[model samples]
Target: MVNLQVCSFNMVGILFLLSLILPTISGDCTCDANTEEKHNSAALHYKLGAIASILLSSVAGVCLPMLGKKIPALRPENDFFFVIKALAAGVILATGFIHILPDSFADLTSPCLNQNPWGNFPFSGFFAMVSAIATLMVDAYATGYYTRLHFNKQANAGELEGGANENDGHVHVHTHAVHGHAHGAVIPTESMTLPELTRHRIIAQVLELGIVFHSVIIGIDMGASQSVSTIRPLVAALSFHQFFEGIGLGGCISQAKFETKSAAIMATFFSLTTPLGAVIGIGISSTYNENSPTSLIVEGTFNGLASGILIYMALVDLLAADFMNPRLQNNFKLQLWVNAALLLGAGCMSLLAKWA
Candidate 1:
């Protein structure tokens, strides 16, 4: 009798330890450990499918803007182009605010975390504040570096000019006059010179970094999720998500005016990231725990950082740069329409969070 009691106690102890390792109820329900394992296997396949779908959609979305060079309607100088870019920016802004940040909050505040440090304070706000500051620093540094480089280049050019075009030469005279005219334009115009081109390049590079950060994280999350029912909806939602994100990035790339090869490479990189991330996640899913302490910290930090960068880019680089231009400000009706378009874009993206 005593031996039987000891055996029963040992079984209970083992069960308790198992519960601590993975909190699960022993049942034939859908969410049981065994069911989850099976679902995770199916989810892996579905995630791959989602990755392919999103990659294709991203390619299509980005290619549309690049190929629009053939259409005068999609020209950079057109009013419609401005509206489209603004809408894209709005989507990115909403993505940072609505999607990623909220997910970070949910993960960081999950019941799985220990109550001592995790439950003691507002970690999300603190992390977000740090990220915002870090983004501002990066923006300031990049802009300053480029500005200094431009000044040095101009100084060197002036030195070279002293030996030849001591007076206003043919190219110099034309350029000087055109620079004046460009300044007089209603837009917040800059001398359309090498410096301007350099600035655009820097902006595109940084924007790409910001976007890829979030894209990979989302892809990994989807891949790691062990639920086929959940993964199926994400497959479609993420396709649309990547498509719109591609449009936003594509518009920025268009304005940057990179060389053909460089532009194509950038677009391809964006298109491939989410899918590549899904593949990576699949390979590491056994070791990658979304709810693990390390994962929660890493994901939350990245989410905060990505959110800050996207928000800053959308507000300062995209919206402010255009909205503050004399043309946009002076045209009341166009401004109204653009504002409506912005709101609509943000609304649509935020709504996607319901499923994605």
Candidate 2:
């Protein structure tokens, strides 16, 4: 966890540094003939409305699975939940590969960059590769650290003599029961222990951290824009963006099964980030220049980092976990259906990148 946090913070710092360098590296152009006073007015109004839609969609998406806990079909172990998670994983994967990476390439490769470095090399691919490698390091380190922590907790619990062994540590003992005429073992009491809950909660929180970074950047970009022609279509695209992203986030939050207060806090945070970004954009509109060289570098670098984080989380944490689970592995038909769902979600999100 410490390593992961360090790597993530480093990425954030690199992005911040890049933002600072942009204005110095790039020169501004005269306003386009199409950028009229009337357009600015329309853009402002549309921005305010867009902020509202993003906030609402984010809330609905994140909260849906949390509330669905009451539904038997939507419970974590249920087949329906499995399919939903697979679908969410696909959405996240597409957001990273199709949406964020392409946007980064566009910004980094813009004619605005100096001909020597920006024009000559593929910084987009380089950044993406660095981010991916960094993510792998964090993921490996964090998992090992957490697993050790679990072992330590179990050791501490074992030291206590008959002191609520189940509650005292992260390890839970399972008893396999045999029924008549059954070839394999059949045990019914498969309750999730508190330690398992802790792991899931940790995963959810880390995932949210990654999602929020990109969310705020997207919101800031939307808010700082002055083009209604650009902002108008984005309003609809972003609404769905948040909605699909929310579904991905919501699935993790649901699995964590945080207490009501924690759940509400997480949901609210996800919902407010984009709108908060817009509000910030409105406040700083006078100073913020989206097309400025400085802005592009900053935004592009951050988007690169975010793309890496989301892709890693989606593929490693979300997709691999479910796809490799014994439940999916043992059931061929269910696995086939999940693969289809994954494709469906990825396809839908990829299609949206056309307009967004």
Candidate 3:
């Protein structure tokens, strides 16, 4: 987790530095057209409306899954919960591939960015691949480190208890590993262990980072635009699509099973980030240039990173982990439902992206 955060922050710094050094491309006379600051009251009204609607939708969608304890049907332990996870995973996958990745490509390869570097290479895809590898490294290292730490503590405890036998720690660790892997060739997701819960927690945090990154970018785009026609469709589209993202993130938080305060914090963070970004963009709309070299590189790079993290989590952590669980393997009917739910979610999000 620490490694992941560090890498992201570093990427941000690198993008910032590149933006400073890279020369802007003068694509056409119209490239300077947007530099003029014009305040439109109609656009402002729509933005205010958009902010309120998006906030309400985001809060409601995310809070729904967090209410699982009170609403037993939605609880993670329920067999139906896998269907929700599958749906969420599909939404995230589509968001990465259909929405954010394309946006990154457009931004990095925009006419406003120089062709020498930005257009010369597929920087968006390259950064996305790098981010995915980094996420994998973080996932593997964190799980491995925690597993070792837990077993070492257990070994020490046994030694302190007057040489209480625990198979010298190494053999016990091997046995535990074997037992974990032997569940009908399924991952032990249904069987919650300390390590499993910790893994879920990590997944929640990493997912939040990716979703929030993309959310803020789009929110800013909407907020900074002064065009009423564009903002109108975006207002409805963003509010509608963001609800799916909220549900996906909320489902992960539910699986993590954080305490009340921590869970609420995560939920609120997701619910507010886009709105907060909108507010920031609204404040700076006078000088904000979506087509500027600085904005393009920064937004494009972050979008690339976000796409990678989200894609990795959706494929490996959520879908693969849950689909391979023994519960789904043994229940053919449930498996069909889960897969269908995934398709439904992906299709819904993809359809909505046409507007957003």
Best-performing candidate as measured by TM-score:
3
- Cα-based lDDT at residue 150, candidate 3: 57
The residue-level lDDT of candidate 1 at 259 comes to 60
Per-residue lDDT of candidate 1, residues 182-260 (tens digit): 4321111353454455455556666777787777778777765777877888988888778877887887777766667
Which parts of model 3 have CA positions greater than 4 angstroms off? 1-29, 32-39, 163-191
lDDT of 3 by residue, 1-356 (tens): 22334634653454344333322432242454555444589999999999999999899878877888789988988877888878878888998999999999998998887889998999999988998999898888877776676567556655655454655655655555456444311122455776786688778878887887787788778887887777888877778777877887898888876656667877887888788777766766766667777778888998999999999989999999989999899999999999999999889888977677
Instruction: Give the worst 10-residue stretch by lDDT in candidate 3.
Output: 180-189
Best by lDDT: 3
Pick by TM-score: 1 or 3, better one: 3
Alpha-carbon RMSD, each predicted model = 13.6, 7.5, 6.4
What TM-score would you give candidate 3 relative to the actual structure?
A: 0.83
Q: Could you tell me which residue pairs clash in candidate 2?
A: 22-294, 23-294
- TM value for model 2: 0.79
- CA lDDT for candidate 2: 0.70
Query: Considering lDDT, where higher is better, how would the candidates rank from best to worst?
Result: 3, 2, 1
Indicate the worst ten consecutive residues by lDDT in candidate 2: 175-184
Full-model lDDT for every candidate: 0.69, 0.70, 0.77
The 10-residue segment of model 1 with minimum total lDDT is: 23-32
